[model samples]
Target: MSHTFRRRFAALVLALSLLTLPARALTAQEAGQLLQDYYIDDVSQEVLAQPTIDAMLSALGDHYTTYFTADEYAAFLASMEDVQLTGIGVKMQASENGPVVVEVLAGSPALEAGLQAGDLITAVDGVSTAGLEMGAVSALIQGQEGTQVTITYLRDGVSAACTLTRSSILVAATSAQLLEDHVGLLTCTTFGHDTYAHFTEALDQFPQADRWIVDLRDNGGGLTQAALDTLSVFTGGGIKCYFMDGSAQLSALEAKREQISSAPLIVLTDGGTASASEIFSAGIRDLKAGLVIGGRTYGKGVAQSVLDQYTNPELFDGDAMKITTVRFYTASGSTTDTVGVIPHLLVSPDLAQEVALLLSAAPPSGGTAGYYRLDLNGSWYISQKAALAQPEVFAQLLAAIPPTAALWQGSGDGWNSVQPQQAAADHSIPFQSRLFSDVEGSPYAQSIQRLAVYGVVLGNGQGSYFPKSSLTRAQLAALLAQALNCTVPTGESLFSDVSMDDSYGLAINAIAKMGLVEGVGNGLFRPDDTVTHEQFFTIMGRLAQRVSLTFQISRQGATQEDLDSDRLSRFAPWSRLSVWLLSSSQLDELDQPVSLLWDDVTRIDPTAPISREEAADLLCAVLERTGILPA
Candidate 1:
């Protein structure tokens, strides 16, 4: 049998096995044991000691780890495939008194029965839904096909009751259409069991299209295998993701099928794009198969292993647990866990598809008569006319795009490429200035601008640099990582207070791995605490040491009286050495102390917090002293 057929057959068999499995009751202890054995992290005995399975799972604080009863398991399994469930079909959310109807699907029984959005469902078959969970309310509404359900709802202060027959409704997991310019647009709402097949069907309908856009915005992920299979259709066989469990070993998830189309692919993403959706996005990017354009994706890098009676007949009868078993990474060993996959082109989610379409346009044949071809980081063919239509967004993109972005201009096959600024001046497109609006007057302005051009430092969104603010631990780590071009680690952090979810956790881990930083105590890296002058100097000293530079002054260079001065004594014994090193070290050509304290002075105060400007000066000084940065 074909690999695709084998995969589908396996999925079908798994679903069928779930239905035929014996309904046996599982003890809470068994559930806890299963979780302890297979969960991504080791569980403490205290957490597992919770009286019930639900309590144990909840205490872990892993929202993805869930225990499902037989009926719930059936629904869970069904949700992984195309939607075909017996329901009245009104999407609802829990409210104070009952569930509020949010949406009514077209041709659904609820819509036919005159239910509308904003209607509060008070009861289901005379049973009050007040304060019930959404799952409970849904369970009360869905039943066997042809079964009748009575729903009591309030519409604008008036109560009404309706009895409707539930029917099977099919919601397509994937939708396809040929868009303007022959670009095939495939929107996948989920990575379901049949999603790969649906994608292939979509591709078959648009064989003539040379470019395709896969829109994954707001697509909460589903089956991992489904996502891999669908990605295979575009990228052919390769490693889709890397999985690391409690074992701490990276394992590759390979796509085994040949590609269906060699057309240039573009992926659209948003903050709501997660999990299997992320898997597909990362695969497209890492495999060099497509370009991702949109907002940062929802960072969901962990995969859950669903265990049930069908798989472990001896342990579970009907109930099952979906436990987080591993953290997944990109094929390049980078993670989309807390640090989501940042798009190559970051546009508003609403405009992502439009921008992608613009990017997919071929370079003009007649050589740019009405159009100007632009290239940003190898992604090309954005036209000036189309860009000018969305001036505000184009300005935003121009700001984000590097200053090195090239532009082509001419007429009738005589196009000439020019610098971005030159092209912007010629075409009247606004460009971002390298200097911050507020930093031109700061003492460290020159250093900050240099770093900014190198992409080491960035201004706050409003274009101002908060130079007076004290630098926090997290911010320091991020700056150091960027300045050094450190490869941020994707594994679990060593510090207890930092998780993969923390914005700067990856940077912290990266610096920690380089032995330039450490936790304060008790395995806690106080990421929010401000960095003191002494602490900053110590880290700089470590950095200098790593690069084989010696900043420490010998006895001949500094007298015993100078070494024992109160200024040096104020610092901690362990920090005094680094402080002295920094105070004595001079810039190569300038012959000035590397340490820049308050008010641009060389004096060091061990206890005082370092301001943002001071930190920038200090970093530049260190880099210059060590020959890492041009003096």
Candidate 2:
């Protein structure tokens, strides 16, 4: 036979063998019976099956959707509940100048590593990112916490290398301040699980304030329950708010608790405050809780209930759609749906400086001014003063509010575990030679091990846990996903270069959805990219946002100082994220960056990819600092 004819014969035989195997594998009788049972009885079955099969096959033509399955559905739910994932902290868009950083979160590893707004990311790691789509480039930059990623980019005319350690990046939700004047300022980013708690905590400390200012600007809403809980504080046994289900009226808020405070209240709102934030604001305004301030609020009075099955069992998980089931109404039966609550005191961002002018003409005792000084003893001392005679200086001082609370002197001393070196000497244990034995007996070991067991750390990839390798972007993202028990997406690759088989593909997709990172261009995703120190800080900042959104405490009247500043630092980008979260209110103090203590970098290697060892150490450190890990 000719060679071509022989090859064709072999190919035919292979095709026949492939087709024949399935029948043999399933027993011909059983296969035939099953087919007959489902399809042979009716012509409709045969016709419908063909169309259904055709539709399924056509859907698979787009690789992105081909991978969807029952498992994928669960994974999608997990992503939404957590609301965010890990990656480098930078907002990117296809601008006229090409992909540009729109905003850089303050105190993120990105900022620490020297990546700035307007700096063009030309490459990720060593791969040229040219022509790659934004999402693909973002995938390259995100990863497990503590893993290192390298970024090569151009700033001005200079080429530079920045290594960033990805950490769990969270979007912030609530920010509060006891303004120098006795007015309490609170900003809610979103109405998530913890928002009410955060607000309560802020309020509890400032019960004596004369007036309160609630800032809900730029707050895109979240959980309905959160909004109800927030509104409950200011309302008496009155109709808190109502929801309209189609044409029927549904009472969403039946007064659960008696009103906590009825002090003169002022709510600041803007275009960014929508959904649950609007509901809460409108409830207060209608119930006579406070005065509404600032620009017009975003009109998102519709309520949505999300059912997600993939989230942690402790969270709301089920197959649920966030459909607009109800339209929110104020206590007075007025609809603030598309037409949001107009502020009783309309203060525009541009006119914010005129607050002094507005105040000067008002009553003098209505507002008070003060400065906070942290004593070496950990006690915060408030120095009362009259409102500043100079308007510009007062605004500058307010603008300089520390992004995070000052380190409490008592915190380090109270929670400090004996240093390993000191503990060894004090206990008469040998230091280096008996390291493992010492660790076994050390009280701090349990806390460290807990973090490790939680998948927050996996030692170094090698058998030895280096404990000091700098964290990289990829490593941090992985650890964060693990810590949150985030469901990562899997299937055909979304980027041109990233294969479906790549191990980190799911995580990359999760982070991309969270808006923590962005791509360079084209369809490439350089997963092996290293990150810079500044980028690491930005990732922490993003994590802070998630933390704030997920966890919140309520406070009564507004005060001049934040009580939870130290807690916010673990999520480093709290300052900027706080702004986005609380864009509605008059509290502008949180929009500024806070200064980090000089020694904050000792635990992190600023130049290298944050390694697994570093991630473990940092996780332990945070847990310890937060008192989650016992001393």
Candidate 3:
């Protein structure tokens, strides 16, 4: 409906409901009259037998079709579009005095203005929140962007007022990250206003990756325009969906020409996928651009349009409702309402690891795959040339790879994983440098290079190692965990400050469980905090004990345990070493826990923040002392 028509209709409805009939009482006759005038269902008031509003709606059997009061309507619209309120970024929770700031997002005006979590907002814009609910206070805080909203908050029972300019703050609905085999993993939580733009930017970040994975699992969906815009990224431009409105008027939404990539794609879906996400999945599957994997999606083929009633206060009294007025179908004319689009390949969400493995190793649904490895159980169809051209990675793979690991290639029924014994014979495979470009002349470059090849360290995933930067607690934990080949514990995290879902949780908890490192307190592993030189050395010493390795520079070769032949690094890369603390003469001196306070290596400011190069140098010295590196 046009805006003008909706406004006039709303005014009439409001005026008729309030003035023509006693709406305050909402008698059966008046309710029946309103339903007859505005309800989309076919039931007539004459057939309702003077039924009450609830009875009439119940008889119609359209659960989604209902009435709303002023507050309910406002809440409904807020839930749908979130109202795009301009306010400082702080989520509020109900408190006796007012609303308490439960969270303060980083880089937000609230945080920038020194607002902290747990603050009680007693007033907003000079209006006291003494008798207001959290919702009422939240409404008072919202205003136009660039307008100053003054807030009075109490911390420790001391009140202070601050004025902050409101701005639009949105979390990216789409995120991009590089995964194993250099695949660009892009997951869209929902199609929001800026989701398409964020997705396009994410695609540009991994131009080197040849394949991509689009994870749409658990996405409930969002604006239809966002879905159409996102489809354009993959298809260049195409008819996305056809819509049939209440008046039987049909329209098609075609994507604009702003294609991102045509890479071999794999999509993940689950029961939460609906509406906009369903449209996206249909396009990818129908066009053969990607294979949809995981459980069946949520079927929602109908769209709801707002029934605006803010136009007339006399009739609707500032209340409104929504109706499912449009039915949508995919470009292929497939409508998923009660029956979702069954995946081309049905896979369970719990087997996500296997799905990821297949996408990274198995032949893509259509195109040829480059890198793959067969399991130790002797898989079938073992034939395909490895297309991986990364010399450094290949060399590292050949350095000490397990005997059964093999790379695969080709597509569909022609796929296979092979050991590629011929590639191993090509020793002249130029060793590609993986070090930071600026670290060419740094003395620690070779140390960082070999560690990266061994997968013990990594750059920012954008080719920058930031050699001189301070290593975070998480970074050091990952380094030690990887170096010792520690298997991450699958149980719940031991730290309240970190979650198992985060990248650092497993490594940090693994070392903590091994008694190599202790949390700073309160079950909080501050992963972002800087690692101190003293603390790191102490942890490394404990890791050596946990891993059953003893570093001693007695001018002696590595022991049988340290040089296990089955281990790729069993053979000593160095003949001898002269590290001070590990030297036989000095080893017994700092064996005590308290010795770190006076040890020559860390006697001065033991807790000082350590840089990556310094940490690498220390690691290299340990490696040299333990005969893992050549001197």
- CA lDDT of every candidate: 0.73, 0.48, 0.60
Candidate 3 residue spans exceeding 4 A from truth: 1-41, 44-56, 66-178, 204-210, 246-249, 310-318, 352-354, 361-631
lDDT of 3 by residue, 1-631 (tens): 4434333432222111223443333345655555454443445645467466667667665655666665576564344232344678787778667788966754678988999879999889889999897778877877788888999999998999999998875434566767664678777777766777777887788787766778888877767777888877777787887766545456677888677787767677777888888888877766666666666677676765444334433345445544455667666555655335555444455443235434454334454443344332122121123324444344443332232234454444565544434444543664333445656666777666655543445677655778888989888888776665455788898989978898888988887876767888887888999986656655655433322223322224535443333321321223112222232222444564222112343233545787787677566555433323212
- N/CA/C clash count, model 3: 5
Predicted structure 1, TM vs. truth? 0.63
- TM-score of candidate 3 against the unseen true structure: 0.40
The top-ranked prediction according to TM-score is: 1
Candidate 3, residue 542: the lDDT equals 45
Ranking of models by lDDT: 1, 3, 2
Query: How many Å off is the CA of 131 in candidate 1?
Result: 22
* Alpha carbon lDDT at 328, candidate 3: 73
**Local lDDT at 337 for model 1:** 61
Residue 190 error, candidate 3, Å: 3.7
Model 2 misplacement above 4 A: 1-84, 87-141, 149-164, 170-172, 175-186, 204-213, 246-252, 258-266, 304-318, 347-631
Residue 531, model 1: Cα distance from true site in angstroms: 5.5
Total clashing pairs for each candidate: 0, 117, 5
TM-score of every model versus the real structure = 0.63, 0.37, 0.40
Q: Please give, for residues 516-539, the per-residue lDDT of candidate 1 as tens digits.
A: 899999999999999998898789
By lDDT, the best candidate is 1
Task: Give the clash total for candidate 2.
Answer: 117
